[model samples]
Target: MPATRRSSLAIAAALLAVAANTAPALAASAPAVPNAPMIPSGSAPHLVGPHGEILHSSSSNWSGYATTGAKFTSVSASWVQPTATCDGNDSYSSFWVGLDGDGSDSVEQTGTEVDCSEGSPLYSSWYEMYPAYPVNFNDAVRPGDHFTASVTAGDGGSFTLKLSDTTQGWSHTVKKTLSNAALASAEIIAEAPSDASGPLPLTNFGTVDFTGAKVNDKPLGSFNPDNITMATNGSTLATTSPITDSKDFSVSWKRSS
Candidate 1:
């Protein structure tokens, strides 16, 4: 059928408008915005491998020792929760000891969180099994408190997470159960937790010394673990402070972002 002159003119005009607006519409939607930091949540970060396995990247927000390929039944570490400066907005970080979640789907973990909420430094303790939300404990953790935390895996997906403040002679423990956990890697770490937007900025915890790090019945040195330094965009975010013995180590905060 032959098109009418008026109908042909309308179609041409519509096509021209569409082409003129396409690039502008795309440009409006494609710019990336900076993400603000928030409190920690959910599973830790990893880059998915081609084979569907999790792999570590230098840019990750974790600095610590991870033992891979070994089934970890238990992991533990001790550190003095450092007093953090809350000069910057939305600054946060966590010091923890955990099994799994370094490269797999599940984490049985517990530790202390140092976060700046509205310019005030806040301290607390919490535990989480991945795929489920984390829970904060009622126990008070002050700056410079000596903390010892441990996580142990048990039969039928049961697990135990314990946190002790040896400086204050206070301790809290919880037992919970999870399903289909991989039990892949064990870690003792200082982490900038993930938020709805991705990795949150680590708080200025100054220097955190980790002592008595152990997995199963062996010290961290016995496993030939990876000493991780968290970085991003060619800048260092955190670093392993030092160790007189592998059983004891530290992570020093470099920059918040």
Candidate 2:
């Protein structure tokens, strides 16, 4: 606290002229920005302007008239609308939700039970109607029949489903359906369904909603539905149940010309 020395020589000459103009602008911009594409300074690609308003990347942290990232803490539009486009409309983007997607055009399920033992049944069932148009896990669903399927039961039963399985010639998704309208000729006269025979072909797997029913595929001492009814037609698929009072209940098929 002696003499002032003229305010510390004018703040040391303004800190040496701001360190000589920041070291020559960082040595002439580090060799013209070598290895560029480094937009990572907290990842930047921000576009959410306003006049019409549009900027969205929310994990959820939006608040008030100025915000960014992790979330802006909490505040929003009551009268600040601007989803972007005073007049440049044309945005097409959204992708995910497609594992045989569920746009449902023909995926039926039904029931109207009264099983006196298996003869008072009226039912319907069809799976994979529209959402199954994405085949080719190995291509081969395009045989002489073009992937067929069928199941009609209850007094005039019907069952047909020939996807070229001279014994696994290549086709599977009946991985099991139906439960047993005699299980389609006892697994199509038993065997060569392309080799691994016996258990699969249990086309009559009735586990949809009647509570229980499983035949030749025998999940364990089968048949248990007081009643059921179902339907489908992207070509053909039906089911009617009665279980056993003798009004005739059991159908099957495989046709899709």
Candidate 3:
């Protein structure tokens, strides 16, 4: 998982959990899957311009805006669920808002996912307190659903992760604890989700538009965020747009890699 440094114990536990159940509680909906891990493939190297402007950065699995250099307490964003165009290949993507994944080990995050399996598309939602496995919500998720999500850090290693699909009339709230969380950065991202092996191919999720992006109750751009482009082996997989109104932006899928 990209910023989630899972321990051997966590991996073993996740595998056991999956082995214990051949099927999820509901057959018609997505199972309580845990494979979407944010494992950082590589450090995002920051590029600064001559005038000291934050130019851009690149990651293997992440594309969006991440702000560091401050102790961030909260991050929030809203986006319409993107429709995934599936082929025969298995691919995965997620849209989310999170904290502590830029330079730190843990990520407290929640959002939605679109995955391709056997030429079909699966839409679901989930949250992860990294190092631990992600827990998928059973709520029905469809393309074009309006979603809002946030991660807020409280005192004493406590945190709240919330995701709401207004288009579907449902919401999920999770409270977790990460005693060593860095609170180092906040981000709104579109990601190519990963598993134990490494990053999976990105789904063709056309474009996801993010709005009302905020960190610590202020516009995200106020902190000078890094615009991340997702690439691997010099091949672009996704690209993030420049932030406008200090709050809105979009991420477009480029290739499956």
Q: Give the TM-score of candidate 2.
A: 0.17
Q: List where candidate 1 sits over 4 angstroms from the true fold.
A: 1-57, 241-243
Query: Which of the two, 2 or 3, has more TM-score?
Result: 3
Model 2 lDDT, residue 215, Cα = 25
Candidate 2 regions exceeding 4 Å error are 1-164, 167-223, 231-239, 244-257
Please give the lDDT score at residue 232 for candidate 3: 87
Measured by TM-score, the strongest candidate is: 3
Q: Model 1 over residues 133-155: C-alpha lDDT tens digits?
A: 56667556778888899999999
TM-score of each: 0.76, 0.17, 0.85
For residues 44-70, could you state the per-residue lDDT of candidate 2 as single tens digits? Answer: 233444432223211110110111121
Query: What tens-digit string does per-residue lDDT give for candidate 3 at 101-138?
Result: 87776889998888766566777789988767678887
Candidate 3 Cα deviation (angstroms), residue 66? 0.4
